[model samples]
Target: MSKKVTGNAFDAKIFKRLMGFAARYKWQFIVSTISAILMSIVSVAKPILLQKIVMIYFENKDKEGLLNYSLLMILFLLAEVILQFLFIYIVNWMGQHIIKDIRIQLQKHMLQFKMSYFDNSSVGKLVTRLVSDTETIAQFFGQGLFMIISDLLKMFVVAIVMLWMNWKLAFIAFIILPILIYATKLFQIAIKSAFQEVRIQVANLNGFVQERVTGMNIVQLFNREKIEYENFIKINNKHKKAHVRTVWYYSIFFPIAEILSSIAVGLLVWYGSLDIVNEGITDAGQIIAFIMMSQMLFRPLRQIADKFNTLQMGMVAGDRVFEVLDTHSQIDKTGKVEAKDFKGNIAFKNVHFSYIEGEEVLKGISFNVNAGETVAIVGATGAGKSTIINLINRFYEINEGEICVDNQNIKQYTLKSLRKKIAVVLQDVFLFSDSIFNNIILSNETITLDEVKNAAKEIGIHEFIMSLPNNYHYNVKERGAMLSSGQRQLIAFLRAYVSKPSILILDEATSSIDSYSEKLIQQATDKITRHQTSIIIAHRLTTVKKADKIIVMDKGRIVEQGSHLELLHKNGYYKNLYDMQFASEVA
Candidate 1:
C-alpha cells in the first residue's frame, strides 16, 4: 500500500470520513455538544459569581446577600457536574456505536474481497484493522472531538469573562498565550510523526507474533526457537522504542505547558498588584477571579494538545482502515444466471491463468467434464493442479479463458448460487472452533444434528464421532487441532457430503493419510462421487485407478488423458507414472 500524505490533526478529508460514522448518531452527538456547552457556561459563571460574592456581599458584611450568592453558586456547580456526566456518557455511547458500525462494515467489505487479495495480504494486519484500528477511531469520537470542542468553548468563554472583568488584567494573563500556542504546534508536529511510527511498529509486531505463533510447530520441529526468539525481541524492542518516543514527546510537552500555565498565573498576580497599588483600578476579588479565569483558559490550552494527539492517532487508524474498505478486488457476482438448475457440466476452453503477471500456472489448458463424470487430474507439484479447482470456484479470475457450465459461461452464473452447488475438500482441511455438528452443518438450519449423524454414517465416520466423549457435540478446537489429520479429513468429507453438491472437487484428499484412513476415505469418496461430476486431484496413482478418466499433467499441459486401462495399454505418461509408483511400492 502507498503511504497516505496526512496533513494535520484537523485533516478535513480524514476527519470528514470519520464523522460519517458519527453522523449516524447525530442526535446523540448534538445532545453531547449541548451538554458540553452547558457545562462550559456553568463553569464560566462560577468564577464570576465568586468575584461578585467577594466584592459586594462578603466585603460589605451582607450576610443575606452572601447566603443567596452561595446558594446560586452551589446550584450552578451541581448543574455543571450533571452536564459533564451527560457529555461523557453520550460521547462514549456515540463512539461505541460508531466503531461497531465501522467494524461491521469493514469486515463485510473484507469478506467480499477475492482470494487473490488474501493471498497477497497479511492476515494479522487485516485483523488489526478490524479490531485495534477501529478502536482508535472510536477514541476520536469519545475523547478527542467533543472534549476538544468543550475545552475550546470553556477557554473562549473564560477569555470573554476575563476581558469583561478587567481588560488590563486579561492582557497580562495572556502574555504566555502565543508561546503556549507555538509549543503546542511544535508538539503536534513531532508527535504526529512519532505516532505514525508507533502505529506502523504496532502492526508489524502484531503480524510477527501472529505468524510466529501460528507456525510454532514448524519452528519447533526445525529447531528455530532461538533464532525466532531473537527476531521477536527485535520487533518487540522496535515497538517499545516507538511508544517511548511518543512518551518522550508527552513528557517534554506537558511540563512546558505546566510551567507556562504557572507563569501566566504569576504574571496575573504580579501585574494586578501593580494596577491595584499604583492606579487602584483592580481589587482583590477581581484579581482572584482573574486567577481562576486564567487557569480555566490555560488548562484547556494544555488539554487541547493531548486531545489533538488522540484525534491524530484516530485519523492515522482511519486512513489504514479506509484503505481496506476502498479496495475493489471483490469477485463480480452480477451474473444473471443462478445455479438453481445447474447440470454439473464443466469445461475449460483454452484457459490461460497466472497468479502473477507473465508467469502462467495454467497455459491454455483445455478440458471438459460431462454431467456426472468422474475425472481425476494428476501432476507433480506446481503443475497447476489446485489452480484448476480454484478457477472452477471463481476464487481467482482467469487471465484468459472460457469456463462454462452446461454450455453457459461460468462468469454468467451468480457466484453464491454457483458455489453453493459445488463443494471442495482441500488437503489441509480447516475447521472452526466449534462442535463437530456445527462444523459439519456450518450452523445451517436446514441440516439438523440427526441429518449430520446420518451423513456421518453414510461416510462410515459415525462410529468414530460416537467414540468421542461429546459425540457429535464435541468441540474440534482451532483448525481441528484436537483431531488427527485423517479424522479431520473425515470431517471434511462429511461436510462436503452434507452439502449434496452437484460437483465435488477433492485436491489430494487422501494423499497424506494412513492406509486405514485412506480405506475409509476411499469408501466415502466412492459413495459421494457416485453419479455426481467429481474432479479429483491426487498424487497417489492407486487412488485414481478407479476414476473414470485420468489426466496426466506436466509443466502446465496435459501429457495424456484416458481411462485407467486405456492409458495403461497406451503406455504413455499415465502408464509411466503408475508403473513407477507400483514398482516403488513393491520395493
Candidate 2:
C-alpha cells in the first residue's frame, strides 16, 4: 500500500502534543509572545504619528512641535527594534531546546522498536524523520507561529484605526478584501498538496542515496554503475518536480496579491479626489495615513497566508514523527525470573517455527544438551541449522515450543539476565567503528583492559592484535573492514570469551577462517567448550569432529544422533555428508 504524504490540516491532537514539548519553556515563550504583541501595537502607532506630523505639526509652521513629535517617533522606532531583537533571540532559543528534546525522545523510542520493524523499514526514511522533519517543526516554533500571530493582530489594529480615521475611505480601501480572501484560500489548499508531494519525494531521494552510497562497492564490483546512476537521476528529477510545483503555486499567489494591493491604492486616490471635490471631507495627512494603513492591512493578509504554509509543513512532519512514537511493536519483556547462576542445561521440546506463517523451518524438532556438554548440529543449507541458534537466543519467538535452560522455561528468565548467560559468534561478524579493545570489551565496566588482554592471550590472538599499528587501540574501521576475515573471526571469539558466559554459540565460525587461523580457533574452541554448554552449527563438518554429540537434521527434523565415529558407522545422512566432503577434498 502507498503511504499518504500529508496529514490532517490543523490536527489538534498533533498540535497539542507538539505544544507539550514547547511547554517545558513556557515562561520564555510567554515573554516572546508579549513582545510580539507590543511590537504590533508599536507598528500600528507609527502611521498615526506620520499623520499627526503632516497635518497637526508640519502644517502649523511650528518647528518646535515638529521636533518633539519627531523625537517621539524615533523613540518608538528604537523600542520596536529592541523588542524584535529580544523576541527573535527568545523564540529561536525555545525552538532549539524543543527540537533537542524531541530528537532525544525519538531516539529513545526507536531503540525500543522490535527487530522485525527494522527488518522491513528503511533506515534512510527514519533518518529523515529524526533530522529533516524535526528541523521543519523547529521553524514552526521559531518563526512561523509568532510571525503569523503578529501579522493577524497588526491587520486587526490597522482595520480599526482606518475605520476610525475616515469610514468612507476605509470602505473604498477594503473593497478588494473578498477577492483577496478567496485567492488566499485557494493558495493555501494548492500549496498544502504541493508541500506534501515535496516531503514524500525528499524521503524517497534520501532512501535511494543512503542505500546506494552504503553499497557503492557492490555496485561498482558488479559493473552496474551506469544503471544505478540512471536510477538516481530519475529519483532526483521527481524530487525536483515536487519542489517546482510549490514554486508554481507561489508564483501564481504573490502576483495576484500585488495586483490587489495596487488596485486598493488606486481606489484610495480616485475616490479621495471626489471627496475633496464634493466637500472638505478629508485632509492630505489623513489621506496619506490611509494609504500607509492599507499597506499595513493588506500586506499582513498576504504574510498570514505564507506563514500558515510554514505551519502546515510543520504539522506534516509532526504527524510522521508521532506515528513512529506511537508504534507499539516492542518485544514483551515481562519475564520476572533472573538466571543469576545459569548452568546451561538446554532443551527444545516439540519446536515448530517459521519466519513466515505456514512455512515451517523447525517443525516438531526436539533436542537436549546436558550441562558442560558440547553438541554440533550439521545439515544442508536452509535445513534449520541457523534457525535453531536464533530460537535458542530468542531472537524470534517459537510458534509452538518450549525452550528451556537450567530446567526452567527460557522465557521465565529476564531477557537481560538470560542473554548475559550466553554469547554468540557468527561467521559473518560485525564490529563497530571503534578501537579493537572497545569492540571486545563493549564498555562493560566490569571487564577491564587487562582482563580483555588476558582473554585474547588465552585465545592465542594476542600476537595478531599486537602486529597492527597502535596494537589493541587500533581502529577497525566500519564493520571491521581493516582486518582479514580470520582476524575478525578471532576478534569475535575473543569478544565472546571475555563475556565468560555459561553457554557459547558458534554458528559456522570457522567456515571462512584460513587453515592457520582454523588451527588456533580449534584449540581455543576445545579449551572454551571443556566446561561450558556449547552449540556449534557447522557446514564443513571438520569443525564439529570433536563434539561429544552430533545431531544430523534434514527438512527440520533430526535424522541421526551419535558421536563422530558412531555417525560415520551409521552409513546414513552424516555418513553421506562426510563421504561427500572427503571425496571433494581428495579430488
Candidate 3:
C-alpha cells in the first residue's frame, strides 16, 4: 500500500494529464486565469496611486487632488478584491468538476479489471485511490496550480514596478531575495519527500482500519479485541509521525522566510533614508511605495513555497491514481460474436491453470457434457472446484487450452454474451442492501415482478417469502445480513432461475443449512436443474446421488468418474467418499 515517490518535486507529464480533465471547462479556466492576471495588475496599480497621492497632491497642499486620488486608490482596491474573489471561486469550481470526472473514470476502469487484479490488490487501498487520492488532486487546481500562478504574477508585476520607480533602491531591496529563493527551493524538495511519506501512511492507516472494521465479527468471535486495538495504535502512531515530519519542515522554513523578508524591508528603508538626506533624490512617498512593494515581492515568494508543497502532494496522489488507470489488467472484450440461442453443450480441452506460477490448480484435464445433461464435480478443499467455475465465467485468463460452449470457443463470443447464457448460485450468496424484489430482478427492466413471483412459486419459495413482513419488498440490508444463510440461498435460487440461463451452476448450494431450509432448497434445485445444463459442486455426496454423472477429484486432479452406484461398485475415490459421508450421517 505504501508506494514510493519515484517522481520529481514537479512532474510536467502528470500536470498536463490533470489539465486534460479541465478540457470540458476551458472557458471557466480561462476566466480564472485572466482574473489572476487582472488582480496582479490592479494590485501593482494601488501602490503607484498611493505614491502619486503623496508626491503630487499632498506635497503641493492640494486637498481636493489628495481626496480624489485617495478615492481612486479605494476604487483600485475594490477591483483587486473583486478579481481575487472571481479567481478563487472559479478555480475551486473547476477543481471539483475535474475530480468528479476522475473518480468516475477510475471506478469504471476498476470495474473492467480481471478478477486476478483484485485478488492481488487490497480493497482498502483501492478505496483510498478512488476517494482520498482524487480529492488531493482537486487541491492541485484549487490551492496549488492557480494560486501559485497568481502569487507569482503578483511578484512579477511588483518586481517590474519596484525597478521602474527607482532602480538603485530596487537593487538594494532585492539583495536578500537570492537567499530566500534558495531556502524556498530547499524547503520544496524536503517537504515533497515528507508529503509522499504522509500519503503512504494515510493509505496504510485506511487499509488497516477498513479490514479491521469489516472483520470485526471475526475479531470479536476470537477474542482479538485488545490485540486489534494495540495493532491499531501502532499504525495510528506511524500516521501521526508521517504528518509531524511535514510539520517539522514547515516550522523550520517559515521563520527563516520571515527573517529574510524583514531584512529586505530594513535594507530598503536604510538606503532610502540615506539617499533623501545626502542627495535629495528619494522622498518619503517613494520610500513608502518601495516598502509596500518589498512586502508584496517577499510575501508571495514565501506563499508560493507553501503552495508548491500542495502541488507536490497533488502530483504524488496523481501518480498513484494514474498508476491504476495505466494498468492493462482488464479482460479482453474484442470478440464480436454474440451467443444467441445458445445450446447447453460444454467442453474443456486440455485445460491448465495456475493462480500462481508453477503451481497449477487444474492440470491438462478434459471433459464434455451433452446438451441438457446434469453433471456433478465433487472434490476436497483446494481441489480446483471453484477455480473451474471462475474459468467458465471468464473471471480470469487461462494459461493453456480452450473452453467451448455450444461447440464454439468461448473466446469467440463477447464476455457479456457468454456470461448472459450462464447463471451461478454461489455458496455465500451476496445480496445488495436493497429490497428483496430489486435484488431478485437485479435492475433488469425486462423481468417483471409477476415473472419473479411466478419463478418463486415454481421453486416453492413463494410461501416462505410471503411470510416475512413486507414480503418481497423487505430490505435485506448489507450482504443480506438481516436474513438467515438459508434465506439468502433461497433468494439466489430465484434470481438465477428467473434469468433462465442455458447453463446453471450451483456450487455447494445445499451445504451448511438447516433441514427445513435444505428441503426447500432441494425442491427449488429439482425445479431449476430439470431439463437444464447444470453442473453441481458439493462436499455432500448424498446430494449428488441423483446426478447423471459425477467427477471425483483430489489434489487438483480427477481420480474417478461415474454414477453413484457405478463408482460404488468400482470401490474407488467416489465410493470411499460416499461411504465415509454415509457413516458420518448415521453417527
Best candidate, TM-score: 1
Weakest ten-residue segment in model 2 by summed lDDT: 1-10
lDDT of 2 by residue, 92-160 (tens): 888789989999999998886766678778786689899988998898888677777777877888889
**Cα lDDT, model 3, residue 142:** 98
State the lDDT at 294 in candidate 2. 90
Model 1: per-residue Cα lDDT over 1-587, one tens digit each: 74553326777888888888888787897899889888989999988888889977646988888899999999999999899999999999998999999999998999999899999998777988999889998898888988898999888989988888889888898889999999988888788778778878987987889788989999999999999999999999999999999999999999999999888888888888888789778888888898888888988887777788898788878999999998999998879888886677988999999999989989999988989889999877888889999999999999997999899898888888899999999999999999999898887799888888888887788999999989999999999999999999999989999989999999999877788888888888888888889999986656677788888888888888889888889978877777776546643
Better of 1 and 3 by TM-score: 1
RMSD of model 3, in Å? Answer: 2.8
TM-score to native of every candidate shown: 0.94, 0.89, 0.92
Score candidate 2 by lDDT: 0.86
Instruction: Estimate every model's Cα lDDT from 0 to 1.
Output: 0.88, 0.86, 0.88
Candidates arranged by TM-score, highest first: 1, 3, 2
Instruction: Estimate, for each residue in 1-587, the C-alpha lDDT of model 3 and write its tens digit.
Output: 65553334578899889988998998998899899999989999987888888887647978888899899999999998899889999999998999999999999999999999999998877998999889999999999999988998898889898889999889998899999999988887778778777877987887789788989999999999999999999999999999999899999999999999888888889999999899767887888899888889988888786688788779878999999999999888888899986778899898999988899999987888878878999877898888889999899989999999988888889999899989999999999999999999899999998999998888788998899889999999999999999999989988998998989998998886778888877887787778889999976655687788888888878888888789889988877777776556744
Relative to the unseen true structure, what is the C-alpha lDDT of residue 495 in candidate 2, on a scale of 0 to 100?
93
